[model samples]
Target: MNLFSDIRDLVIDTLAAMQGAGELPEDLDFANVTVEPPRDPAHGDMATNAAMVLAKPAAMKPRDIAQVLAARLADDARITSAEVAGPGFLNLRLDAGVWQAILRAVLAEGADFGRSDLGAGKRVNVEYVSANPTGPLHVGHTRGAVFGDALASLLDFAGYDVTREYYINDGGAQVDTLARSVFERYREACGLEPEIADGLYPGDYLVPVGAALKAKYGESLLDKGEEDWLEELRDFATDAMMELIRADLKALGVEMDVFYSEKSLYGTGRIEAAIESLRDKGLIYRGTLEPPKGKMPEDWEPREQTLFRSTEHGDDLDRPIMKSDGGWTYFAPDVAYHFDKISRGFDALIDVFGADHGGYVKRMKAAVSALSDGKVPLDIKLTQLVKLWKNGEPFKMSKRAGNFVTLRDVVDQVGADVTRFHMLTRKNDAPLDFDFDKVTEQSKDNPVFYVQYAHARVCSVLRKAAEAGIDAADATLGDADLARLGHEAEMTVIRKLAEWPRLVDTAGRANEPHRVAFYLYELASEFHSLWNRGNDEPGLRFLQEGDPATSQSKMALARSVAVVISAGLGILGVTPAEEMR
Candidate 1:
């Protein structure tokens, strides 16, 4: 069904035939040969570098080989012409019937047209949005959440066994701070004036956690010391905050398959086991780290510490696993967590982190490399900051979240579909500007609206064709006289559709889901252009006047565009618009 792949295979088969006819050497490697769209459409439909790549290796002139290859390819029914241009590049022009067959393939396959098996069912663990379970998720976490969730979906479509995961940062001192903040709210709920001290979480979201704690423990636990209440309240508050986090994710249509707790690694011998595994490999040692570059800290001094030889595994320097006070450092638990992931036998790992954690990327990768002995690959994607705009100025923060904008605030204002689509307009490594006024604007300038409008227009076409008593169902239209779709505008759309499978494979291989968003925009642009062209050219319209036979063929092409859009939007976790409001 992938016309590009089909054509590429034809080119490779023809090269093999040329080798058999003694036109090229038998030892020439064909791995470098590639068939893709020509850089300038005016040149041809597709281009191949088989002649150019094999010329020097086969000890023959590129044009001489291209001439022979061109003659062999011209014998095939799919290729109309293969012309040698500029040294050795072979540009190919496919027959019009090839595009007709592609349209029929789209009608037959529907949403599953572009699905690929690129990963071959390899297990991949994608961990993202592992924000601290202290309060509601803010805008930074929102980008990571959307990026990670969409990546998981994209990989799933590309045939990877994806496990959507969230690593809870609940084992650190941040949770203790959360417990103290909830204690203040608990006092307020008990009719006592609470102390909203500095360094405590002041968000009103904790008000309910306090109320729930009061209902469960009553006045009995209020008089206890920190030792008695800290552990109990930390567990209670983290659970409540996680519940709030879950609801926030649900609003944005994100659901994790695994919520791995960092606390589970503590007091479970898992940390020791992970460290011991590295120790057995001679990667653990006790040493004093060199002073950091540039200005030294005020208390700079060398001290003996337990360190991991992270430099051996690609880190910039060895990292301390234990502080001078003999307690585990902040990175110890992270090492244990990744070691556990390796023990589970995943073939690959991907972590989606906020831009602030860019420095942690190398060390984390080193840990996984040492733990897995370089058997698995770890890909860390950092989602950059999002700047929200509205009313000609930066958007205001959520009062409920205290200082930052909550995920729910964005979703509630612009809706989940718009929020999700707009968030992915930029790549994960690039900064994004989310303009509230612009995203909701129903114009071509707005990508989300333009793409959704295209889907809605296709639905309108289906409805109109059905009302006209023309059978436009996939099965009926799939068998229509697709040869009537010979117009350049119609063929342009089919050309874009043909790139779907190739696009899926490329995006999956690079771990970039933003490419899907970009492709959808281009496909929508082409579809809208053809729809507009139909106004003046009567033969270009999807529904022909009083001719169901002609109308069905064109309607089939329009419906195929909708099918691909739905499939692309599905990967992005955005529901396709049935009708535009």
Candidate 2:
């Protein structure tokens, strides 16, 4: 179904014949040989650097090898012309029937045309949106949630065994803050003036947690000191916050396969075991470290502490696992958490974090490397901040002003489908602007609308064909005489359809799901352009009044575009619109 792969196979077969006939060297390695669409369409349909890569290895000039390869390729029935160009590159023009066959292939395969087996069913764990369990998810977590969910879906489409995961930061001081914040709300729910302290959460979202606590415990915990109620209240409050987070994630159409807890690492001896494993490998030791470079804190006295030999594994400096105060640093539990993942037998691991965490990437990678002995690879993607816009002004997220935009706020305003699609329109490392006014517009400038419009247009075409008493379903269209779809405009779209399998492999290999959004935009553009062309040329229309065969052939192409559009949007967790509103 992949025309590029099909053409490359032909090129390899021709090269094999050249070696067998003694026309070329017997031991030439063709691993670097490639056949792809030329950068400029004027050059040719396809181009290859086979001769250029083989020249040095074969002890021959590039042009000399290209001249022989060109003649050999031209003899094939599928190749119309194979011309040597620019030192050693070979430009190829295939038979017109080749494009027609691609159109028929789309009709035959439908949405399954672009699927690839690049992952080879390797198990991959993608951990993302692990926001601290302190409150409902805010705007900062939305971008990572959308990006990671789409990435998991993309890898699944490329044939990877993907597990979507979330890690809860329950074993931190933040959960204690959450508990004290909720306690104040509980007093307020009992008709007392709640003290909104400087260090406590001041949002009204916790009012319900307060009310729920009163219903569960009455006034029994009212006068208790920290020792009497801290642990129980901390666990209770954290569970409530996680429930709110789960609801928030569901609003954006995200689901997690696992929700790992850092607290689990504490009681099970997992952290000690992980550090012991590193110690056995000579990667952990008690040492005194230099002060941080630039400016020193007021209490900048050096002290001996337990440090991981992260420098040997490729970090700026060996990092302390335990502070001089005999407490675990934040990075200590993270190392143990990933070790837990490694022990679970995952072939690969991916973490999606905010751009503010960019400085922590190297040490995290080094920790996983030393822990797993470099057997498992780790990829951390940092998603840049998202700036919200409304009425051409920046919409700041400030909790005190009660003006902060939560994930629920955005989803309720625009919608989950629009939110998810717009979030992925840019690269993960690039800052994205979410304009409330722009995303809902039905204009072509909005990619969500543009892509949805393409699908709706195909639906409109199918309805029109059906009203004219023609069978327009896929079962009927797929059996159409697709060779009749031979127009240049029609063939142009078919050529784009042929790039889907290649696109899937490229996007998956690069660990980018944004590329899928970009490709879908381009595919929709090609389909829309063809639809507009049909308006001026009556013969290019999908419905032929007198010839059902021609109409069916053209309808097959349009429906095939719908199939691919649906499949691509599905990977993005977007439901293709059957009709534009």
Query: How much lDDT does each candidate structure score?
Result: 0.93, 0.89
Task: Work out the TM-score per prediction.
Answer: 0.97, 0.96
Task: Count backbone clashes in candidate 2.
Answer: 0
Query: Candidate 2: where are CA atoms >4 Å away?
Result: 22-29, 296-299, 396-403
Candidate with top TM-score is: 1
Where model 1 places Cα greater than 4 Å from the true spot, the runs are: 56-61, 297-299
lDDT of 2 by residue, 427-533 (tens): 99999999999999999899999999999999998999888889987778777787788777887788788788888888999899999899889889989888889
Candidate 1 weakest ten by summed lDDT = 291-300
Clashing pairs in 2: none
Q: Cα RMSD to native, each candidate?
A: 1.5, 1.9
- Global fold similarity of model 2 (TM-score): 0.96
**Clashing pairs in model 1?**
none
